[model samples]
Target: MLAVHQLYGRQSHAIDSGRAADWAATFTSDGEFRSPSYPEPSTGTAELTAFAERFHAACVESGEALHHVISTVDVAATGPDALTSTAYLQIVGTPRGESSRLLRITTIVDELVRTPGGWRIRRRVVLRDG
Candidate 1:
Protein backbone atom coordinates (compact mmCIF):
# COMPACT_ATOMS: atom_id res chain seq x y z
CA MET A 1 0.00 0.00 0.00
CA LEU A 2 2.80 2.38 0.86
CA ALA A 3 4.56 1.45 -2.33
CA VAL A 4 1.45 2.23 -4.32
CA HIS A 5 1.29 5.70 -2.82
CA GLN A 6 4.94 6.25 -3.61
CA LEU A 7 4.37 5.12 -7.17
CA TYR A 8 1.58 7.62 -7.59
CA GLY A 9 3.72 10.38 -6.10
CA ARG A 10 6.53 9.62 -8.49
CA GLN A 11 4.18 9.41 -11.45
CA SER A 12 2.53 12.74 -10.64
CA HIS A 13 5.82 14.53 -10.04
CA ALA A 14 7.30 13.19 -13.23
CA ILE A 15 4.52 14.46 -15.45
CA ASP A 16 4.06 17.75 -13.60
CA SER A 17 7.80 18.45 -13.78
CA GLY A 18 7.83 17.82 -17.56
CA ARG A 19 9.71 14.55 -17.36
CA ALA A 20 7.62 12.74 -19.96
CA ALA A 21 9.73 9.64 -20.33
CA ASP A 22 9.99 9.24 -16.60
CA TRP A 23 6.25 9.37 -16.29
CA ALA A 24 5.75 6.71 -18.93
CA ALA A 25 8.34 4.49 -17.34
CA THR A 26 6.08 3.99 -14.38
CA PHE A 27 3.89 1.74 -16.51
CA THR A 28 4.55 -1.67 -17.93
CA SER A 29 5.95 -2.12 -21.40
CA ASP A 30 2.54 -2.89 -22.81
CA GLY A 31 0.51 -0.86 -20.40
CA GLU A 32 -2.76 0.67 -21.46
CA PHE A 33 -4.32 4.01 -20.67
CA ARG A 34 -7.89 5.00 -21.39
CA SER A 35 -9.39 8.36 -20.52
CA PRO A 36 -12.46 10.28 -21.48
CA SER A 37 -10.28 13.36 -21.85
CA TYR A 38 -8.47 11.73 -24.74
CA PRO A 39 -9.91 10.56 -28.01
CA GLU A 40 -8.29 7.16 -27.93
CA PRO A 41 -6.50 4.87 -25.58
CA SER A 42 -2.72 4.68 -25.46
CA THR A 43 -1.15 1.26 -25.29
CA GLY A 44 2.43 -0.03 -25.27
CA THR A 45 5.51 1.82 -24.17
CA ALA A 46 5.91 3.82 -27.35
CA GLU A 47 2.37 5.08 -27.28
CA LEU A 48 2.55 5.84 -23.60
CA THR A 49 5.71 7.82 -24.12
CA ALA A 50 4.09 9.71 -26.95
CA PHE A 51 1.09 10.47 -24.82
CA ALA A 52 3.24 11.96 -22.10
CA GLU A 53 5.21 13.96 -24.62
CA ARG A 54 2.04 15.37 -26.09
CA PHE A 55 0.82 16.35 -22.64
CA HIS A 56 4.07 18.12 -21.94
CA ALA A 57 3.94 19.89 -25.28
CA ALA A 58 0.40 21.04 -24.67
CA CYS A 59 1.32 22.36 -21.28
CA VAL A 60 4.30 24.18 -22.76
CA GLU A 61 2.21 25.72 -25.52
CA SER A 62 -0.36 26.90 -23.03
CA GLY A 63 2.32 28.12 -20.64
CA GLU A 64 0.72 26.30 -17.81
CA ALA A 65 1.86 23.62 -15.39
CA LEU A 66 -0.58 20.76 -14.98
CA HIS A 67 -0.61 18.74 -11.83
CA HIS A 68 -2.38 15.43 -11.23
CA VAL A 69 -3.54 15.37 -7.65
CA ILE A 70 -4.50 11.87 -6.60
CA SER A 71 -6.29 11.17 -3.36
CA THR A 72 -8.57 8.73 -1.51
CA VAL A 73 -6.88 5.75 -3.00
CA ASP A 74 -8.55 2.37 -2.58
CA VAL A 75 -6.63 -0.78 -3.35
CA ALA A 76 -7.63 -4.43 -3.46
CA ALA A 77 -5.50 -7.41 -4.11
CA THR A 78 -6.44 -9.35 -7.21
CA GLY A 79 -3.76 -11.96 -7.15
CA PRO A 80 -0.39 -12.76 -5.67
CA ASP A 81 1.27 -10.29 -7.97
CA ALA A 82 -1.56 -8.10 -9.08
CA LEU A 83 -3.85 -5.54 -7.53
CA THR A 84 -6.53 -3.02 -8.45
CA SER A 85 -6.49 0.55 -7.25
CA THR A 86 -8.98 3.35 -7.56
CA ALA A 87 -8.40 6.97 -6.70
CA TYR A 88 -9.72 10.46 -7.16
CA LEU A 89 -7.76 12.62 -9.53
CA GLN A 90 -7.89 16.36 -9.67
CA ILE A 91 -6.17 18.15 -12.48
CA VAL A 92 -4.95 21.58 -11.47
CA GLY A 93 -3.56 23.97 -14.01
CA THR A 94 -1.33 26.86 -13.01
CA PRO A 95 -0.68 29.35 -15.73
CA ARG A 96 2.62 31.20 -16.06
CA GLY A 97 1.52 34.30 -14.24
CA GLU A 98 -1.89 33.51 -12.86
CA SER A 99 -3.58 31.67 -10.08
CA SER A 100 -4.09 27.95 -10.24
CA ARG A 101 -7.36 26.64 -11.59
CA LEU A 102 -9.12 23.35 -11.29
CA LEU A 103 -9.11 21.87 -14.76
CA ARG A 104 -11.13 18.77 -14.02
CA ILE A 105 -11.91 16.04 -11.57
CA THR A 106 -11.84 12.36 -12.42
CA THR A 107 -11.64 8.90 -10.99
CA ILE A 108 -8.81 6.64 -12.03
CA VAL A 109 -8.96 2.88 -11.83
CA ASP A 110 -5.66 1.11 -12.26
CA GLU A 111 -4.70 -2.52 -12.61
CA LEU A 112 -1.19 -3.04 -11.35
CA VAL A 113 1.21 -5.92 -11.54
CA ARG A 114 4.38 -6.62 -9.68
CA THR A 115 7.33 -6.69 -11.99
CA PRO A 116 10.96 -7.53 -11.44
CA GLY A 117 11.78 -3.85 -11.23
CA GLY A 118 8.84 -2.97 -8.98
CA TRP A 119 5.14 -2.33 -9.17
CA ARG A 120 4.02 -1.17 -12.61
CA ILE A 121 0.64 -0.18 -13.87
CA ARG A 122 -0.77 -2.65 -16.39
CA ARG A 123 -3.82 -0.63 -17.26
CA ARG A 124 -5.55 2.58 -16.20
CA VAL A 125 -8.98 3.93 -16.90
CA VAL A 126 -9.97 7.51 -16.16
CA LEU A 127 -13.57 8.54 -15.83
CA ARG A 128 -14.34 12.23 -15.71
CA ASP A 129 -16.72 13.45 -13.05
CA GLY A 130 -19.77 15.35 -14.19
Candidate 2:
Protein backbone atom coordinates (compact mmCIF):
# COMPACT_ATOMS: atom_id res chain seq x y z
CA MET A 1 0.00 0.00 0.00
CA LEU A 2 2.88 2.34 0.76
CA ALA A 3 4.32 1.65 -2.65
CA VAL A 4 0.95 2.29 -4.25
CA HIS A 5 0.70 5.69 -2.60
CA GLN A 6 4.21 6.53 -3.75
CA LEU A 7 3.26 5.53 -7.27
CA TYR A 8 0.24 7.83 -7.12
CA GLY A 9 2.44 10.70 -5.98
CA ARG A 10 4.84 10.16 -8.84
CA GLN A 11 2.04 9.78 -11.36
CA SER A 12 0.50 13.07 -10.19
CA HIS A 13 3.84 14.80 -10.60
CA ALA A 14 4.20 13.40 -14.07
CA ILE A 15 0.77 14.68 -15.00
CA ASP A 16 1.44 18.11 -13.51
CA SER A 17 4.69 18.40 -15.50
CA GLY A 18 3.09 17.33 -18.75
CA ARG A 19 4.93 14.06 -18.76
CA ALA A 20 1.91 12.37 -20.20
CA ALA A 21 3.60 9.24 -21.47
CA ASP A 22 5.26 8.68 -18.14
CA TRP A 23 2.01 9.22 -16.37
CA ALA A 24 0.29 6.67 -18.56
CA ALA A 25 3.00 4.13 -17.92
CA THR A 26 2.19 4.05 -14.25
CA PHE A 27 -0.80 1.86 -14.98
CA THR A 28 -0.89 -1.80 -15.91
CA SER A 29 -0.73 -2.86 -19.53
CA ASP A 30 -4.50 -3.40 -19.45
CA GLY A 31 -5.42 -0.55 -17.19
CA GLU A 32 -8.52 1.55 -17.33
CA PHE A 33 -9.06 5.18 -16.36
CA ARG A 34 -12.48 6.75 -16.00
CA SER A 35 -12.81 10.44 -15.29
CA PRO A 36 -15.51 13.07 -15.56
CA SER A 37 -13.61 14.89 -18.28
CA TYR A 38 -14.16 12.04 -20.68
CA PRO A 39 -17.32 10.12 -21.27
CA GLU A 40 -15.61 6.79 -21.86
CA PRO A 41 -12.87 4.96 -20.07
CA SER A 42 -9.35 4.95 -21.47
CA THR A 43 -8.23 1.35 -21.54
CA GLY A 44 -4.82 -0.14 -22.41
CA THR A 45 -1.61 1.68 -23.10
CA ALA A 46 -2.38 2.98 -26.57
CA GLU A 47 -5.70 4.47 -25.55
CA LEU A 48 -4.24 5.80 -22.34
CA THR A 49 -1.33 7.32 -24.23
CA ALA A 50 -3.60 9.15 -26.61
CA PHE A 51 -5.75 10.42 -23.78
CA ALA A 52 -2.73 11.62 -21.82
CA GLU A 53 -1.20 13.31 -24.85
CA ARG A 54 -4.41 15.07 -25.67
CA PHE A 55 -4.83 16.14 -22.09
CA HIS A 56 -1.33 17.57 -21.97
CA ALA A 57 -1.83 19.40 -25.23
CA ALA A 58 -5.01 20.93 -23.94
CA CYS A 59 -3.32 21.99 -20.73
CA VAL A 60 -0.45 23.53 -22.64
CA GLU A 61 -2.80 25.35 -24.94
CA SER A 62 -4.73 26.66 -21.95
CA GLY A 63 -1.43 28.00 -20.56
CA GLU A 64 -2.24 26.83 -17.10
CA ALA A 65 -0.29 24.63 -14.72
CA LEU A 66 -2.62 21.81 -13.84
CA HIS A 67 -1.98 19.95 -10.63
CA HIS A 68 -3.70 16.93 -9.10
CA VAL A 69 -3.52 16.97 -5.35
CA ILE A 70 -4.37 13.57 -3.90
CA SER A 71 -5.10 13.14 -0.24
CA THR A 72 -6.79 10.92 2.34
CA VAL A 73 -5.63 7.79 0.61
CA ASP A 74 -7.39 4.86 2.25
CA VAL A 75 -6.16 1.46 1.25
CA ALA A 76 -7.74 -1.93 1.78
CA ALA A 77 -5.85 -5.13 1.12
CA THR A 78 -8.32 -7.30 -0.71
CA GLY A 79 -6.03 -10.29 -1.02
CA PRO A 80 -2.39 -11.21 -1.31
CA ASP A 81 -1.97 -9.33 -4.55
CA ALA A 82 -4.97 -7.09 -4.79
CA LEU A 83 -6.16 -3.98 -2.99
CA THR A 84 -8.66 -1.15 -3.14
CA SER A 85 -7.94 2.47 -2.47
CA THR A 86 -9.99 5.62 -2.28
CA ALA A 87 -8.53 9.10 -2.23
CA TYR A 88 -9.59 12.70 -2.50
CA LEU A 89 -8.72 14.33 -5.76
CA GLN A 90 -8.29 18.06 -6.05
CA ILE A 91 -7.44 19.31 -9.50
CA VAL A 92 -6.04 22.81 -9.44
CA GLY A 93 -5.13 25.11 -12.27
CA THR A 94 -2.52 27.82 -11.84
CA PRO A 95 -1.64 30.14 -14.62
CA ARG A 96 2.01 30.93 -15.05
CA GLY A 97 3.14 32.87 -11.99
CA GLU A 98 -0.39 33.29 -10.74
CA SER A 99 -2.53 31.96 -7.94
CA SER A 100 -4.15 28.57 -8.23
CA ARG A 101 -7.83 28.00 -8.90
CA LEU A 102 -9.73 24.90 -7.95
CA LEU A 103 -10.98 23.23 -11.07
CA ARG A 104 -12.49 20.09 -9.61
CA ILE A 105 -12.81 18.17 -6.41
CA THR A 106 -13.62 14.49 -6.64
CA THR A 107 -12.97 11.13 -5.09
CA ILE A 108 -10.96 8.48 -6.89
CA VAL A 109 -11.60 4.81 -6.27
CA ASP A 110 -8.82 2.58 -7.50
CA GLU A 111 -8.70 -1.17 -7.91
CA LEU A 112 -5.10 -2.21 -7.84
CA VAL A 113 -3.17 -5.41 -8.43
CA ARG A 114 0.35 -6.28 -7.56
CA THR A 115 2.56 -7.10 -10.47
CA PRO A 116 6.09 -8.36 -10.86
CA GLY A 117 7.36 -4.84 -11.33
CA GLY A 118 5.20 -3.11 -8.73
CA TRP A 119 1.64 -2.27 -7.88
CA ARG A 120 -0.46 -1.07 -10.80
CA ILE A 121 -3.93 0.34 -11.10
CA ARG A 122 -6.33 -1.98 -12.90
CA ARG A 123 -9.22 0.44 -12.85
CA ARG A 124 -9.69 3.95 -11.54
CA VAL A 125 -13.09 5.49 -11.16
CA VAL A 126 -13.50 9.17 -10.41
CA LEU A 127 -16.64 10.45 -8.74
CA ARG A 128 -17.68 14.00 -7.95
CA ASP A 129 -20.36 15.42 -5.65
CA GLY A 130 -23.78 15.90 -7.16
Candidate 3:
Protein backbone atom coordinates (compact mmCIF):
# COMPACT_ATOMS: atom_id res chain seq x y z
CA MET A 1 0.00 0.00 0.00
CA LEU A 2 2.66 2.44 0.99
CA ALA A 3 4.71 1.44 -2.03
CA VAL A 4 1.80 1.99 -4.35
CA HIS A 5 1.09 5.40 -2.87
CA GLN A 6 4.73 6.40 -3.16
CA LEU A 7 4.92 5.33 -6.78
CA TYR A 8 1.76 7.26 -7.63
CA GLY A 9 2.96 10.34 -5.82
CA ARG A 10 6.37 10.27 -7.47
CA GLN A 11 4.92 9.82 -10.94
CA SER A 12 2.45 12.63 -10.38
CA HIS A 13 5.19 14.94 -9.20
CA ALA A 14 7.37 14.06 -12.17
CA ILE A 15 4.59 14.88 -14.58
CA ASP A 16 3.74 18.11 -12.81
CA SER A 17 7.34 19.20 -13.06
CA GLY A 18 7.76 17.99 -16.64
CA ARG A 19 10.42 15.52 -15.58
CA ALA A 20 10.09 12.98 -18.33
CA ALA A 21 13.02 10.82 -17.27
CA ASP A 22 11.82 10.67 -13.71
CA TRP A 23 8.34 9.71 -14.80
CA ALA A 24 9.61 6.98 -17.08
CA ALA A 25 11.81 5.57 -14.33
CA THR A 26 8.67 4.58 -12.48
CA PHE A 27 8.16 1.75 -14.95
CA THR A 28 9.99 -1.57 -15.18
CA SER A 29 12.33 -2.43 -18.01
CA ASP A 30 9.70 -4.45 -19.85
CA GLY A 31 6.75 -2.35 -18.92
CA GLU A 32 3.93 -1.29 -21.21
CA PHE A 33 1.93 1.90 -21.34
CA ARG A 34 -1.13 2.66 -23.41
CA SER A 35 -3.37 5.68 -23.94
CA PRO A 36 -6.24 6.53 -26.24
CA SER A 37 -4.19 8.97 -28.23
CA TYR A 38 -1.32 6.57 -28.77
CA PRO A 39 -1.84 4.50 -31.90
CA GLU A 40 0.01 1.58 -30.32
CA PRO A 41 1.20 0.72 -26.87
CA SER A 42 4.73 1.61 -25.84
CA THR A 43 6.87 -1.28 -24.62
CA GLY A 44 10.10 -1.37 -22.64
CA THR A 45 11.63 1.31 -20.52
CA ALA A 46 13.61 2.95 -23.32
CA GLU A 47 10.59 3.35 -25.54
CA LEU A 48 8.52 4.54 -22.61
CA THR A 49 11.12 7.13 -21.73
CA ALA A 50 11.23 8.37 -25.31
CA PHE A 51 7.47 8.52 -25.36
CA ALA A 52 7.45 10.67 -22.23
CA GLU A 53 10.00 12.99 -23.76
CA ARG A 54 7.96 13.37 -26.91
CA PHE A 55 4.82 14.01 -24.90
CA HIS A 56 6.50 16.71 -22.86
CA ALA A 57 7.96 18.27 -25.98
CA ALA A 58 4.59 18.41 -27.64
CA CYS A 59 3.01 20.03 -24.58
CA VAL A 60 5.81 22.55 -24.39
CA GLU A 61 5.63 23.36 -28.09
CA SER A 62 1.93 23.93 -27.76
CA GLY A 63 2.62 26.31 -24.89
CA GLU A 64 -0.04 24.65 -22.83
CA ALA A 65 -0.49 24.64 -19.11
CA LEU A 66 -1.24 21.16 -17.84
CA HIS A 67 -2.16 19.61 -14.53
CA HIS A 68 -2.98 16.08 -13.42
CA VAL A 69 -4.89 14.79 -10.46
CA ILE A 70 -5.02 11.15 -9.37
CA SER A 71 -7.37 9.75 -6.77
CA THR A 72 -9.43 6.82 -5.48
CA VAL A 73 -6.77 4.15 -5.92
CA ASP A 74 -7.91 0.64 -5.20
CA VAL A 75 -5.08 -1.86 -4.87
CA ALA A 76 -5.20 -5.61 -4.69
CA ALA A 77 -2.13 -7.63 -3.96
CA THR A 78 -1.52 -10.29 -6.57
CA GLY A 79 1.64 -11.64 -4.99
CA PRO A 80 4.11 -10.82 -2.29
CA ASP A 81 5.75 -8.38 -4.64
CA ALA A 82 3.03 -7.50 -7.09
CA LEU A 83 -0.30 -5.69 -7.08
CA THR A 84 -3.01 -4.49 -9.40
CA SER A 85 -4.71 -1.17 -8.88
CA THR A 86 -7.10 1.30 -10.41
CA ALA A 87 -7.42 5.02 -9.89
CA TYR A 88 -9.31 7.99 -11.23
CA LEU A 89 -7.51 10.73 -13.14
CA GLN A 90 -8.45 14.24 -14.07
CA ILE A 91 -6.34 16.49 -16.27
CA VAL A 92 -6.71 20.05 -17.47
CA GLY A 93 -4.73 21.76 -20.21
CA THR A 94 -4.83 25.36 -21.38
CA PRO A 95 -3.61 26.34 -24.81
CA ARG A 96 -1.08 29.12 -25.26
CA GLY A 97 -3.65 31.86 -25.67
CA GLU A 98 -6.83 30.19 -24.55
CA SER A 99 -8.69 29.38 -21.38
CA SER A 100 -8.21 26.06 -19.60
CA ARG A 101 -9.68 22.99 -21.21
CA LEU A 102 -10.39 19.73 -19.49
CA LEU A 103 -8.22 17.16 -21.21
CA ARG A 104 -9.62 14.06 -19.64
CA ILE A 105 -11.50 12.40 -16.83
CA THR A 106 -10.56 8.76 -16.80
CA THR A 107 -9.54 5.64 -14.96
CA ILE A 108 -6.07 4.13 -14.86
CA VAL A 109 -5.70 0.41 -14.27
CA ASP A 110 -2.18 -0.73 -13.53
CA GLU A 111 -0.24 -3.85 -12.70
CA LEU A 112 2.78 -3.13 -10.56
CA VAL A 113 5.64 -5.08 -9.17
CA ARG A 114 8.02 -4.39 -6.35
CA THR A 115 11.52 -4.26 -7.77
CA PRO A 116 14.93 -3.53 -6.29
CA GLY A 117 14.28 0.07 -7.24
CA GLY A 118 10.94 0.09 -5.42
CA TRP A 119 7.47 -0.16 -6.94
CA ARG A 120 7.37 -0.07 -10.73
CA ILE A 121 4.50 -0.28 -13.15
CA ARG A 122 4.49 -3.35 -15.37
CA ARG A 123 1.42 -2.47 -17.34
CA ARG A 124 -0.94 0.48 -17.44
CA VAL A 125 -4.23 0.79 -19.27
CA VAL A 126 -6.04 4.10 -19.34
CA LEU A 127 -9.76 4.16 -19.98
CA ARG A 128 -11.53 7.40 -20.70
CA ASP A 129 -14.75 8.25 -18.95
CA GLY A 130 -17.53 9.95 -20.83
Candidate 4:
Protein backbone atom coordinates (compact mmCIF):
# COMPACT_ATOMS: atom_id res chain seq x y z
CA MET A 1 0.00 0.00 0.00
CA LEU A 2 2.82 2.37 0.76
CA ALA A 3 4.36 1.59 -2.59
CA VAL A 4 1.01 2.19 -4.28
CA HIS A 5 0.72 5.55 -2.60
CA GLN A 6 4.22 6.46 -3.68
CA LEU A 7 3.43 5.43 -7.22
CA TYR A 8 0.34 7.62 -7.20
CA GLY A 9 2.33 10.53 -5.85
CA ARG A 10 5.07 10.10 -8.43
CA GLN A 11 2.54 9.89 -11.22
CA SER A 12 0.88 13.06 -10.06
CA HIS A 13 4.21 14.79 -9.82
CA ALA A 14 5.17 13.66 -13.29
CA ILE A 15 1.88 14.93 -14.64
CA ASP A 16 2.49 18.24 -12.94
CA SER A 17 5.81 18.39 -14.73
CA GLY A 18 4.22 17.39 -18.06
CA ARG A 19 5.79 13.96 -18.31
CA ALA A 20 3.24 11.57 -19.76
CA ALA A 21 5.26 8.37 -20.09
CA ASP A 22 6.36 8.41 -16.50
CA TRP A 23 2.80 8.94 -15.35
CA ALA A 24 1.39 6.20 -17.57
CA ALA A 25 3.89 3.62 -16.37
CA THR A 26 2.27 3.59 -12.94
CA PHE A 27 -0.55 1.33 -14.13
CA THR A 28 -0.67 -2.37 -14.97
CA SER A 29 -0.56 -3.56 -18.55
CA ASP A 30 -4.25 -4.38 -18.51
CA GLY A 31 -5.27 -1.54 -16.30
CA GLU A 32 -8.41 0.49 -16.66
CA PHE A 33 -8.53 4.19 -15.89
CA ARG A 34 -11.58 6.41 -15.91
CA SER A 35 -12.25 10.13 -15.48
CA PRO A 36 -15.37 12.25 -15.69
CA SER A 37 -14.67 13.35 -19.26
CA TYR A 38 -13.80 9.85 -20.43
CA PRO A 39 -17.44 8.67 -20.15
CA GLU A 40 -16.04 5.12 -20.40
CA PRO A 41 -13.02 3.29 -19.12
CA SER A 42 -9.67 3.40 -20.93
CA THR A 43 -8.47 -0.18 -20.98
CA GLY A 44 -5.06 -1.77 -21.61
CA THR A 45 -1.63 -0.26 -21.55
CA ALA A 46 -1.84 1.22 -25.04
CA GLU A 47 -5.12 2.95 -24.39
CA LEU A 48 -3.93 4.27 -21.05
CA THR A 49 -0.69 5.50 -22.59
CA ALA A 50 -2.60 7.34 -25.27
CA PHE A 51 -5.00 8.80 -22.75
CA ALA A 52 -2.19 10.09 -20.58
CA GLU A 53 -0.40 11.56 -23.55
CA ARG A 54 -3.49 13.33 -24.78
CA PHE A 55 -4.37 14.57 -21.30
CA HIS A 56 -0.92 15.92 -20.71
CA ALA A 57 -0.78 17.49 -24.14
CA ALA A 58 -4.09 19.21 -23.63
CA CYS A 59 -3.16 20.53 -20.21
CA VAL A 60 0.23 21.75 -21.34
CA GLU A 61 -1.12 23.27 -24.52
CA SER A 62 -3.67 25.11 -22.43
CA GLY A 63 -0.72 26.39 -20.37
CA GLU A 64 -2.00 24.99 -17.09
CA ALA A 65 0.03 23.88 -14.14
CA LEU A 66 -1.67 21.00 -12.36
CA HIS A 67 -1.25 20.22 -8.73
CA HIS A 68 -2.80 17.15 -7.16
CA VAL A 69 -3.19 16.54 -3.46
CA ILE A 70 -4.20 13.13 -2.20
CA SER A 71 -5.33 12.34 1.32
CA THR A 72 -7.30 9.88 3.43
CA VAL A 73 -5.95 6.84 1.67
CA ASP A 74 -7.74 3.81 3.07
CA VAL A 75 -6.55 0.43 1.88
CA ALA A 76 -8.33 -2.89 2.32
CA ALA A 77 -6.39 -6.01 1.45
CA THR A 78 -8.70 -8.35 -0.39
CA GLY A 79 -6.11 -11.03 -0.90
CA PRO A 80 -2.39 -11.58 -0.71
CA ASP A 81 -2.14 -10.11 -4.18
CA ALA A 82 -5.10 -7.79 -4.38
CA LEU A 83 -6.38 -4.78 -2.50
CA THR A 84 -8.94 -2.00 -2.76
CA SER A 85 -8.33 1.57 -1.70
CA THR A 86 -10.03 4.93 -1.61
CA ALA A 87 -8.54 8.37 -1.28
CA TYR A 88 -9.68 11.95 -1.22
CA LEU A 89 -8.05 14.07 -3.89
CA GLN A 90 -8.03 17.74 -4.67
CA ILE A 91 -6.66 18.96 -7.98
CA VAL A 92 -5.91 22.57 -8.76
CA GLY A 93 -4.63 24.08 -11.98
CA THR A 94 -3.82 27.51 -13.26
CA PRO A 95 -3.45 28.70 -16.80
CA ARG A 96 -0.12 30.34 -17.44
CA GLY A 97 -0.22 33.90 -16.17
CA GLU A 98 -3.57 33.24 -14.43
CA SER A 99 -4.51 32.56 -10.85
CA SER A 100 -4.86 29.01 -9.57
CA ARG A 101 -8.37 27.54 -9.52
CA LEU A 102 -9.82 24.34 -8.21
CA LEU A 103 -10.11 21.72 -10.89
CA ARG A 104 -11.85 19.07 -8.81
CA ILE A 105 -12.22 17.51 -5.41
CA THR A 106 -13.09 13.83 -5.51
CA THR A 107 -12.72 10.35 -4.13
CA ILE A 108 -10.48 7.99 -6.04
CA VAL A 109 -11.36 4.33 -5.65
CA ASP A 110 -8.70 1.95 -6.88
CA GLU A 111 -8.23 -1.76 -7.28
CA LEU A 112 -4.61 -2.87 -7.16
CA VAL A 113 -2.83 -6.15 -7.56
CA ARG A 114 0.66 -7.32 -6.79
CA THR A 115 2.64 -7.95 -9.91
CA PRO A 116 6.24 -8.75 -10.76
CA GLY A 117 6.77 -5.01 -10.87
CA GLY A 118 5.18 -4.57 -7.46
CA TRP A 119 1.67 -3.30 -6.80
CA ARG A 120 0.11 -1.85 -9.92
CA ILE A 121 -3.26 -0.23 -10.29
CA ARG A 122 -5.71 -2.53 -12.09
CA ARG A 123 -8.60 -0.12 -12.10
CA ARG A 124 -9.24 3.41 -10.95
CA VAL A 125 -12.60 5.12 -10.60
CA VAL A 126 -12.89 8.78 -9.72
CA LEU A 127 -16.06 9.99 -8.05
CA ARG A 128 -16.79 13.66 -7.72
CA ASP A 129 -17.34 14.76 -4.15
CA GLY A 130 -18.19 18.40 -4.71
- Clashes (backbone N, CA, C under 3 Å), per candidate, total 0, 0, 0, 0
User: On residues 1-130, what C-alpha lDDT tens digit does candidate 1 reach at each position?
Assistant: 7789999999999988888888898999999999989999999989998999999999999999999998999999999999999999999999999999998999999999999999999999998756
lDDT of 2 by residue, 7-88 (tens): 8999999877878788888889999999987889999988988888888888889888788999999999999999999999
Q: What lDDT does each candidate get?
A: 0.93, 0.89, 0.87, 0.83
RMSD of each: 0.7, 1.1, 1.6, 1.4
- Cα deviation in Å at residue 82, candidate 2? 0.2
Q: List the residue pairs that clash in candidate 2.
A: none
By lDDT, who's the top model here? Answer: 1
Off by over 4 Å in 4: none
**Which residue runs of candidate 1 sit more than 4 Å off their true CA positions?**
none
Cα lDDT tens digits for candidate 3, 80-117: 99999999888888888899878888899999998998
TM-score of 3: 0.91
TM-scores, one per candidate: 0.97, 0.95, 0.91, 0.91
* Error of model 4, residue 10, in angstroms: 1.2
What shift in Å separates residue 89 of candidate 4 from its native position after superposition?
A: 1.9
Native-vs-model 2 lDDT? 0.89
